[model samples]
Target: MNAHNIDIALVGAGMGSESCLTKEVKNLIDNADIVFGAARLSNSFGDSDRQNVIDTYRVNDMIEKLEEADKDIKAVFIYSGDSGFYSGAEAAYLRVKEWAEEKKKENADLNVNIEIKAGISSVSYLASRIGISWQDAKLYSLHGREYKGRVPEVIESARYNEKTFVLLSGASDVIRLTDEILNIKNVILYLGYHLSYDDEEVMTITSDKKEEFLKGEIKEGLYTAFIQNVSPETKYLSYGIPTEEYIREENVPITKEEVREIVLSKLRLFRGCTFYDIGGGTGGVTVDVAKISPDIKVISIEKRPERTELIRKNIDKFGLRNVTPLTGNATETLALFDENNLVKNDNEYENYVREIIKNNPPDRVFIGGTEGQFRDIIRELKKFGRKIRVCMTAVTLETRNEILKLADEDTVDDLSVVEVNISKLVRLGKQHMMKAENGILVATFQL
Candidate 1:
């Protein structure tokens, strides 16, 4: 061993210093020359003798101190929770490895060794206390991540996952997320707060008192995780949201659940994909697309004023923040840029896409209400290059043939058409019967 070498060890401290420290980790920490970690975590070692502990949480500062130390020293970095589950060990390991590489490049003889030891994870502990298996739980965290675009995932988890757990922090307080879920009225929450601590509290909240429970004074404990059961076995995973769920206007056209599911299936959207629901009608497609993922941006383009308002209502009812309703003809609205840069020329649609859509070309476009400008819309999509996906739905055979003819002329390859006829149940009098909806053909064109 080099006299000037530094030996670093990353040890998971579980929840805190009060308890849950493994014997091996405790021994390694006790034998170290100097320790570094968060203030509370480092101080938890109770290593006051020789004043050898540095109670700081800065990674760069630790690296610098390790480099500046003169003598060969045993250094250990402390982290909370298990080193396997979103712990700080991986981050510290990378920084230390980079430092070791740079040092080796400078002196070729420097010796550095890093050892990682695991500890109990809060999620596992919580699951044990709740008497449930975490093997199937969906893990998520708002501890240091954005919550607006992430809530939909957790909500969907509750809907489709038997046990879904989310780590809570200042970005998305559990109470705040629960309040948002209140609008959905479908989740049953199981909470674990301050796990393994004296103040640890575990509880369950059902629909009966969820509103009042969320409204109550809820404290942020030492650590918080929740298991939400939306009963996936009994629920559809949001793609096939029923037709009657949305707020629709009298005699206004709305995409039925069956057709909407197929349209979204054809679109096959990914994360952060931009979707255009031209002739959005009741915003069913837009709402369903937005529900697919929180980060997916959806724009509803409708020329009708009443339908636009109805779309807005559906959006509000669903509590979706990723959708925008633009009221204007697709031919005209797709031409307009943002508030400050509306395109003056119809041919300047590319400029409109750049200025208004934030430089994001439509990843997928669903045309349900393009009047006679289908040819123009097809031409514009083809002009944009091969990165956009287009799916158009037509109720009449003539419209379907017209779109197919345009697709052929545009050199669009392998265009597939799926005709969907939804059979819904209706009451004829005392008994119910299947009501066959109009057979609609969905034409999908890939660029």
Candidate 2:
């Protein structure tokens, strides 16, 4: 759109100043009869005609002023970041449409044209500065909004796993989010403030100390928080471990690598899932569940007391929030989770899970190591109406027998058992393949 034909051009000022301004945006600012922008930002429009400029935060007021301006003169409204992405342009367009409609009702003849010009968004700039790409990162804007409940899932996901996150308007959310992060343990935090400015500041911290800093106990400047997993040097030092971590040492722990593949595949977890790895042997399966898909919260139930304690210790080390460790028989705890106790629903066992996913619905459901009581758990899972894909692993003959029984049952929508075995390449004078002593039977149900 040509500025001369445009009644007003809403331009972006990039993130900071004139130096970051695009040449086209600079020209528009220079030639306009009047400029509309934020007070702090209007000063950046060097060489602009000051007498005709208007500086205010309210777009409605600006629209009114623009409507009253001389018809032949050009007016430019400047905004920070891209006009198309969470900028004021959408609000301005709606307001202008409303004004035009009201004028038509009054039978007044007025032509106030409008157009938008895009600019580089702060997300792109900030990500570029950190040598990260926006293609995979989850983007969130906290400006003028509260993120108390809506933020926990994403924050926990970013904190627990290897992923990237971009945030705007983070000045207020850092504290509450940090609290949520602490509950998970061992999260890494990076804060960037006044980016691309001469007074720009950045700080990195752990979830344990995020609250102290956000509370102003630690002096810092305005910034955005980037929460990520701890690197290799500290990987074993994470605050929370998946309940699955406990099982490995008990001589019954699911291998971390094996569990990771199974849980990720069964859950198909993209966002959130409340998974219960019943009969969790030490918690290895649960840890892999939480670690591989940070979004899937795992609640593992083991009957042994020592195993329960081990799960807690591991959770503290890995910093996983998406896991809830329960010590007791799987059947009893599953019974206590009445639908009434859930976010919603009643009469179904999965409602406890359903209520979680209803309030926080899971993308997948897993019942790893359902041996002797496989049929009973399968019956309970059926009550949730099949929104979840239930997966279970059987290793021993007794467990495999239970799985075979489950596979033959008609109560479930569909059931299949897969036998998996692996071998390692062994070499002495010659090379040979040695069967990895472990074998597993995986049962899956779809409803």
lDDT tens digits, residue span 215-271, model 1: 787885554566565545354455878788999888888887788888888888998
Prediction 1 TM-score vs. true:
0.78
Best candidate according to lDDT: 1
Give the per-residue lDDT of model 2 (tens digit) for 125-204: 76667666666666666655556434645654565355445454554566666565545545566667776678776666
Clashes of each: 0, 28
- Residue 371 displacement (Å), model 2: 6.9
RMSD (Cα, Å) for all candidates, in order, is 5.2, 7.8
Off by over 4 Å in 1: 1-4, 46-52, 182-188, 228-246, 256-262, 288-297, 312-356, 359-361, 372-386, 395-441
Location of the lowest summed lDDT over 10 successive residues in candidate 2: 231-240
Superposed model 2: Cα runs more than 4 Å off: 1-10, 16-78, 84-114, 120-165, 168-192, 195-221, 224-248, 255-275, 293-309, 315-321, 326-358, 370-373, 396-402, 421-439
